[model samples]
Target: MVSDKNSEYKFTGGNSLTGIHKLYHEVMMLNELWNGYGAYEVSYAAGKSGISFGGNQMDMHDNKKTAEKFTNILISATDNAGKHFFTQGEVKMIVGNEFVNLIQNGEVVLSMLGDNLASINAALSSVYGRARIDQLYVSEIKNGAEHIEKVIEKITNAAAKKFYDSDLGRVLLFDYHNQYDLKFDGRFLADYINGKGKENFSTKEMVVAPRDHSKYRAIC
Candidate 1:
C-alpha cells in the first residue's frame, strides 16, 4: 500500500504515464495527417467527450485492459532526466460509457442542426444585421448584443434540454457512477504488475499492427 505522504506524487506519475501514451498517439495521427492530407478538422462531433473534448478524452481510453495500467498500482516510476524514481496510490481507473452517451447526444444535436440549418442561418444573419445597425446608432457596439444573446440562449437551451431529457443522457448523468464504479479499478496497476518488470510495462496488443507493413505506406 502507498503511504499517505506519497499518494499525490504517485498519482502524478500515473497521470504522466497515461499522458505520454496519449501524446504519442496524437502526434502519430498528426504526422499521418501532415504526410497525406493537409490539416482539416475531423467531422466527429465532440468525440469521446461531447461538451469538453480535450479534457476527458485523455482519460477515457487509458484505463482499458489492453492499455497501460497505472492508477491502482502502489508504486509508480518516472523518468527524471534519464534516471528513474518511484512514487507511491498513483493508479487511476475511469469507468463509464460517458463517451458512448456523448456520441449519441452529439449525433442528435448534429442532426437537429442539419435539419434546421436554413432557419438557424437566417436567424443568425438577422441578429448580425441588427447588431451592425445598432452599432451605427448607439454609443456602444454591444447595444444589440443582449437581443442576440437572448435569442441564442433560447434556441440553445431548448436543444440542450432535449438532450438532457433523453434516456442516454439521464443514464449518463445519474446512473453511470453508481452502476459502473467497479468498472474503474484503481488497484488495477497493482494487480497487473504483480510479477512484471518495468521493462515489460508497455501495453500489450494495445494496437493491432498492420498485417502488411509495406502496403500501409503513408499517402504522401
Candidate 2:
C-alpha cells in the first residue's frame, strides 16, 4: 500500500523518521514565519503580555512555562558567560517580577521594541537593570533558538500523538493540541472511524472545524 503524502500518512516502523519528523519541520516553518525564526527572535508587542521572547513568542507575563523555558535555556547554555548568567538567578527573579507586575497592573510593560538585534539589546539593557544582571540576557537568551527546537519536540510529544499515522495527521494533531491541550477523545475517534468505514482518513476529513464539532469531539 502506498501512502498519500497530501492526506494519509503511514509510518514505516524502522530507523526512518522522515514521515513524522519532516512534517514537524513543515509545521515549524509556519511558526518561524509568524513567531520569528530561531530562538533569538523577540516579539515586543505581545498583546497583554507586553514583551515576548524566543522563537515561539514565549510571553513575559504571568506565564510559568515561558519562564521555565528561558531558565532551561540559560542552564543549557554552552558558553561560560552564558552558563554563569543562569547561576546568578536573575532570570527567575525578573520573570517573577513580570508575573507580579501582571497581577498588580494587568500588564508587564517593556520599553523594548524587539524589532531587531539593536532593539533587543536595548530591551535587554532595561531588563538587566531591573534584574541587576549587568546586561547578560542578550547573550544568554540568544541560545534560546537552539533549545527552542527541543521545546517544540516536547510539545509535539505532548500533543495528541497516537491518533493519526502520517505527516498530515501529526500536523493536524499538533494544531488540535494547540487549541485543546490533551482533551483527545479516543472513543469518539474510534466511533467516527467505524461510522465512516474507512481504514485511512485524510487531513481534510479528519480535521474538525469548530462549528462542525460535537460534544464528544475526536480532536478537541
Best by TM-score: 2
- The lDDT per prediction is 0.25, 0.35
Candidate 1 local lDDT, 86-128, one digit each (tens): 2321112111232232223434434533533333222212323
Q: What overall lDDT, based on C-alpha atoms, would model 2 receive against the true structure?
A: 0.35
Local lDDT at 102 for model 2: 22
Number of the top lDDT candidate = 2
User: How do the residues 28-139 of candidate 2 rate in per-residue lDDT, one tens digit apiece?
Assistant: 3354224223224333543344344432334545555555544444434333233233343543444354444322212334432123334232332232322322122232
Q: Where does model 1 exceed 4 Å of error?
A: 1-27, 30-39, 45-104, 115-191, 194-220
Tell how far residue 62 is off in model 1, in angstroms: 16
Error of 2 at 93 (Å): 4.2
